[model samples]
Target: MDMMVSSLQQQRAITDQLRREAGIKRIPVSQAVEDIIKYITEHEQEDCLLVGFSSQKVNPFREKSSCAVL
Candidate 1:
């Protein structure tokens, strides 16, 4: 019982540390979906390219990137 709880806490701590190290921001699934839907709705009339970044360093939208889009 106590051991199980301790293990879960340790796992959560490790997950959080990894996310921090990787610059990953955690968002709720519903919020992410809603944001995507909103973006699509706003741009439905325009030709859109959904660019994806596998890592933050390559993302142009990130302010920290050297080639960030202004």
Candidate 2:
């Protein structure tokens, strides 16, 4: 268990370094959820416009995979 935790910490350090080098933004999940909820509430989707969503079976954490909410 100690080895696993240490390995995870090392991996996290590498990930943080890579993200810093790439200039990526990391949004807190709570903040993102709050923003999404606020947007939906303020927009009040009463117009009943075309709402579309699609997703594929893939590891969302993969750098090559993507998702959009619009």
Candidate 3:
């Protein structure tokens, strides 16, 4: 029993040391969700529509937008 407890403690210490060395830390779940939402909103128009839309839909919009002027 004593040996088991010592082994568990040693394992925990090693895990903690590894996490610290790797800069692995926990964030609140809400913060993670917020970051994901912000990233999706920022990237959605450029990544999703640009690839998924038909050229017919895309070319007209592009012609009306800054890309046309460029």
Q: Estimate each model's TM-score.
A: 0.36, 0.35, 0.39
Model 1 misplaced regions, further than 4 Å: 1-23, 48-70
lDDT of 2 by residue, 9-63 (tens): 9999999999898897678999999999998887765423333223333334346
- Native-structure RMSD, model 1: 14.0
Cα error, residue 64 of model 1, in Å, equals: 41
* lDDT for each residue of candidate 1 in 14-42, tens digit (9 for 90 to 100): 99998888896679999999999999888
Output the lDDT of residue 53, model 3. Answer: 59
Give per-residue lDDT, candidate 1, residue 50.
Answer: 56
Which ranking of candidates, highest lDDT first? 3, 1, 2
Candidate with best TM-score: 3
Model 3: what TM-score? 0.39
lDDT of residue 69 for candidate 3: 46
CA displacement after TM-score superposition, residue 20 of candidate 2 (Å): 8.6
